[model samples]
Target: MAWMSWTLPTAMFFITIAVILISMTAWQIISPCIERRGFLPLATTRGDRLFIGLLSSAFIHLAFVALTDVNIAVATALCAIWMIVLMRWG
Candidate 1:
């Protein structure tokens, strides 16, 4: 896709997503998950929670970038923390 600039950061982002997906799939195969209720309103499986976490993290990053002048690292750190919390007790 020459139309799009495949910069290092962009490439790394996509690679990271691919790696996460692969790892999750392997995890599922090794140990199937049961749907469980957490702080979130509905019972959800690991994959469901992961999807929600990633989607929410996207919004979190967008909000950070749009609403503040702080470094993007702050958003990344927040997203990491939020992901851990969500995966553990969302």
Candidate 2:
């Protein structure tokens, strides 16, 4: 197979996303989603929160990269924390 060019961080990012998607699918099969209200203005299901989390993560990364000299690691860490919060309570 011909390999595509990708850096370690890029490869890890896609791998992480794939793992999350697989786990989410398994969770859905094991227990169907039920909507709930939390910090968000409206009730949302797991899938909804996942989408919102991803958007917020992208926004966070963009803001961090554009506005500050902080390391990408720090930005990624912030995105991760945001994802966990959204998943748990958004």
Give the local distance difference test score of model 2.
Answer: 0.94
Say which candidate scores most in lDDT.
Answer: 1
What residue runs in model 2 are displaced by over 4 Å at the alpha carbon? 1-4
Q: How much is 78 displaced in model 1, in angstroms? A: 0.3
- Which pairs of residues clash in candidate 1, taking residues 3 or more apart in a chain or in different chains? none
Model 2, range 1-90, lDDT digits (tens) per residue?
Answer: 998889998899899999999999999999999999999999999999999999989999999899999998899898889999999989
* Global lDDT of each candidate: 0.95, 0.94
Cα lDDT tens digits, model 1, 21-89, are 999999999999999999999999989999999999999999988999999999999999999999999
